[model samples]
Target: MSDKTESVSTLENAMQLMIQTFHKYSGDEGDKYTLSRAELKVMLTTELGNYLGNAQDKNAVDKVMADLDANGDGEVDFTEFIILVGALTVACNDFFLEYNEKGEKKK
Candidate 1:
C-alpha cells in the first residue's frame, strides 16, 4: 500500500484503540460517567492547549468553558470527553497529514 494509505490506516487504528481504552478504564456505557460538552472542552483547553496557537490566552479557555457548559455545571462527563477527543483527533490527524504531504513534496 502507498504511504498515505498506511498513514490513514494507522490513524484509524489509533482512534479505535483510544475509544477502547477509555471504555475499559471508565466502564461500560451504562456505568460510565458522562461529561457535558462544555466541561470536556474546558478540560481539553487546560490539558491539550488551544491548537489555534493561543495557548497562553486564558480568555480562550474561559470562552470554551462557557460555550460547553450549557447546564451551568462545573465539570464534564465521559460522553463529552469522548466527543471532544474524537474532534481533536480528527483535527490533529488532518494537520499531521497536510504537514507530511508538504514535507514530502519539498523532498
Candidate 2:
C-alpha cells in the first residue's frame, strides 16, 4: 500500500484501483463497509464476469459468498475480497507462465 505522501507507482495504482472497485459496489442497501449478497452478485457479474466465468449463475454466487464469508456473517468484507483477488492474480500468473513455456518449447 502507498502512503498518501508517496508518489504512486504502478503497483500502488493497482492497489488504489482495488480499493476503488470495492467501495464502488459495497454501499448500496446495506452496511457501507461490507458487501451484502446482492451487492456481491452485482459486483462479480459486472466487474469480473469474464474472469469468474458463470457469476451470473445464482448457485455460483451463493457458493462464492459462502466461501468468502470467513466469519459466516452472510457478507464479504474487504479482507475477504482482497484474498479472492490475490488468489485470482496467482492463478493468472500461473497461466501466463504455462503459456510462455509452451511458446518457448515450440520455438
Candidate 3:
C-alpha cells in the first residue's frame, strides 16, 4: 500500500472516500453542496454500479430521489446523501452476516 493508505485505518479511508465521492458528483451542476437529479444519476451509475439495483433506470433514480429528499427540497444535500450510503452499508452488513451464518452451518 502507499504510505498515505498504509497510515490510514480502513474506516478512515472509507470515510474520506465517501466524502470525496460526494463532492466529486455534487459539484457537477447546481449547488456545489447538493446533488441534482442528473448528478445523482451519474453518481449512482458511476459509483454504485450494480451494488444498487437498476441505478441506470430512470424510475429507480426517481424513487431514490423521492425517498432521500426528506426535506422536500428536491435536491439531496450531504446529510441526505449520507443516509443513502449508511442504509446501503447496513443492508450489506446484514447480507454478509446471513451469508456467513449459512456458510458456517454448512461446514
Candidate 4:
C-alpha cells in the first residue's frame, strides 16, 4: 500500500489515497487514528483548498467537525472522513453533470 502503485486498479488507488490522506492529518496533534478538530481543520484547508475555498474559516471548520464526528467523540474517524469525502464526490459529480448539460443546451 505504500509504494506499489503499478499493480493497483483505479479504485484501489483511490482507496489508498484516501487512507494516506487521512493518516497524513490524523496523526498531527492527537489520536493517530482519529482527527481532532484542529487536525481536521488543517486537513480540510490544506488538502482541499481548491474544493473548499473558505475552509480556513473557523465556523466552517467547526460545522464540518460537528457533522462528521458521528460518535460524538469530538474527533473524526476514518469512516467519518470517508463519509465527508464521498458526499463531496457525489456533489462534484452532480455539479459536473449539470454543467455539461448546460453547455450542451447552449451549443
What is the C-alpha lDDT profile of model 2 across 11-105, one tens digit per residue?
A: 98899999999999998878998999999999999989989999999999999999999999998999999999999899999999999999999
Better of 2 and 3 by lDDT: 2
lDDT of 3 by residue, 1-107 (tens): 45555587899989999999999999988799999999999999998996986888899899999999999888999999999999999999999999999999999
Q: After superposition, how far is residue 60 of candidate 1 from its true place, in Å?
A: 2.1
Clashes of each: 6, 0, 0, 0
Model 3 worst lDDT window (10 residues): 1-10
lDDT: which is higher, 3 or 4? 4
For candidate 2, the TM-score is 0.92
CA lDDT of 51 in candidate 1?
Answer: 65
Estimate every model's Cα lDDT from 0 to 1. 0.58, 0.94, 0.93, 0.94
Clashing pairs in 4: none
TM-score of 4: 0.92
The TM-score of candidate 1 is: 0.48
- Per-prediction TM-score to the true structure, in the order listed: 0.48, 0.92, 0.91, 0.92
Question: Which one wins by TM-score: 1 or 4?
Answer: 4
What is the Cα-based lDDT of residue 70 in candidate 4? 85
For model 1, residues 1-107, the per-residue Cα lDDT tens digits are: 45665455787987777666544444433335543334343444455765645645667656655655556664444555566567777999999999999999999
